[model samples]
Target: MTTTSGFLLDQVMVTRGETRLLDTITAHLPGGHCTAVVGPSGAGKSTLLRLLNRLDDPSSGRILLDGIPITELDVLDLRRRVGLVAQQPVLLTDRVAEDLRVGRSELGDHGIRELLQRVGLPVEFVQRRTSELSGGEAQRVCLARALAVEPEVLLLDEPTSALDGVSSGVIVEAARDHVAAGGTVVLVSHDLAVVRGIADTVLVLDHGHLIAHGHPDEIDYLEAGR
Candidate 1:
């Protein structure tokens, strides 16, 4: 399979209502690796990820994938190739089985089983209603749903922010494995510990601009001495 990867932004800016939420920024996410975006609250980390998935377009400048501009792609096709998983999982009116069975019809059953196993869910979850899922269960289901679309790039915005330690661990491992399998992952989180566990590179954002960018070990040492 062809490994999926993309560039990020070139002096992009974002605004909401009357307030400037994100300032001009430029950063390149290395292909085929997990890049962890970390910072304090209101640091514009989540906004950056949303821009990558086109959930919210930039007010100025542009986000590019490869060398092509993002706005040039078809919205539906773009979303299919780029999956977004938020901190609080949202489920549609469908069973867990039907959710994961969305992308391909032939392997629906097998796909659901495999996804559940990958996300640390038991086979029993297949029949469960989306409404009845617990916090951890819901997040895993959301992940499975994202993967069902066969997306090449996954954008996670605090995906484990609402889960317990055990639950977070499962999702972290799932993210790591996906990257290892040639998929690109961009994760936005404030949890340094979580970043240390899975991130290959780290991007520190503050006030909507690129503050620091380097390997996780570099930041780990910097944080240790502070």
Candidate 2:
């Protein structure tokens, strides 16, 4: 693993033309904690999360993992340690089992089944076609795929949006379980209730700037809006 410590952004900024997508963001997401980034659309929550795993680079400043600049690490190795589950789940192969083996080509059926079980999927799901899965089922499959690599950190964007209670609950528990097992999770969401349940620290953003960050109970999320 490239890092055991969580992410740190130092005076980071992202600019396009005259606009700043993220401005001077500075935060420490410690290992073994769930940190939620929340705000209305265009708040730069996703922008900031994307920077952690090198999906996008900052115009200025740095991002570090385990006290080393992310730019200094091999991008592929970094991604393996810090897995990302995007807003939409995309299966690489038609079958669910093959999709989980993207970063882990040598993973056997036993390992694949364990990953599915970790995400609350049935063993039978291994042979199912991704196209036949429901929204919730697909998301679970994505989660299992991300977990297949045994990532130290998970970056989730809008993880539980528009899902049934059972699926949402499973996703929530997965984040919690990851933290419980000494891993870190950085989650971006519009749902305050979900954030309240999982976030050990909450970051409120507005128009590319970090407005507030602290424990869930300390932040005034009402003013921030979804």
Candidate 3:
């Protein structure tokens, strides 16, 4: 994983017709740290996460990655460096090892097994059929796949939203380990427990507006009914 001064969003806004999904969201998410984005449903959380990896370009504004505007970089190269694990895990291949090697072809069985362990999967899972694993296991494999390239940043969109506590814990541990090892993580989560547990900084959004940016305790999830 590569670490550098991270994302800078300048007056970013996203709109579709008359509706704004994000209203001038500006903030600097430091490298090698975990930043959690929290908001109620319909508050533009997913839309915000998509822009980080150019899954969707911002309607208007500048997003800089490692001091260069992301728009100026090749889309594929940028995505390679900024890997994303969406809420749902969609295994690209039928086999686990093949799915993990999608980004780096030279990744061997040993490397694939190591990645699986890192995400809390048994090494034996290296040869398991994707369709045979449970939801939690598939999600972990998806996370390992993202980590396989050793990306500069991990853009996780509600990764643990649908998992059980045990599964969620594994994912949270993986994110923390990534940051501890100097990789950046940007997470969008509605589960307040997740935000408080792993977030070094929290960004609160409401109705397309950035309402708060500070430590996790700064945002009162109770009062906001998050």
lDDT of 1 by residue, 1-226 (tens): 2222466678898988787767888778876789898877888988888888788999998888876798999988888988998888888756888777665456567778888988889988889988888877888888988987778888888888778898889889989988888888899887778888899888887777677889987774338532
Q: Score every model by TM-score.
A: 0.91, 0.94, 0.94
Q: Write model 3 residue lDDT over 13-129, tens digit each, in one string.
A: 999999999999998888889998888888998898889889999988999988889999999998888999988889999999999999999999999988988888899998899
- Report lDDT (CA) for all predictions: 0.82, 0.88, 0.88
Error of 3 at 223 (Å): 7.3
Off by over 4 Å in 1: 1-5, 103-107, 220-226
Comparing 1 and 3 on TM-score, the stronger one: 3
With a 3 Å backbone cut-off (N, CA, C), the pairs that clash in candidate 1 are none
Which whole-number lDDT from 0 to 100 does residue 133 have in model 2?
A: 91
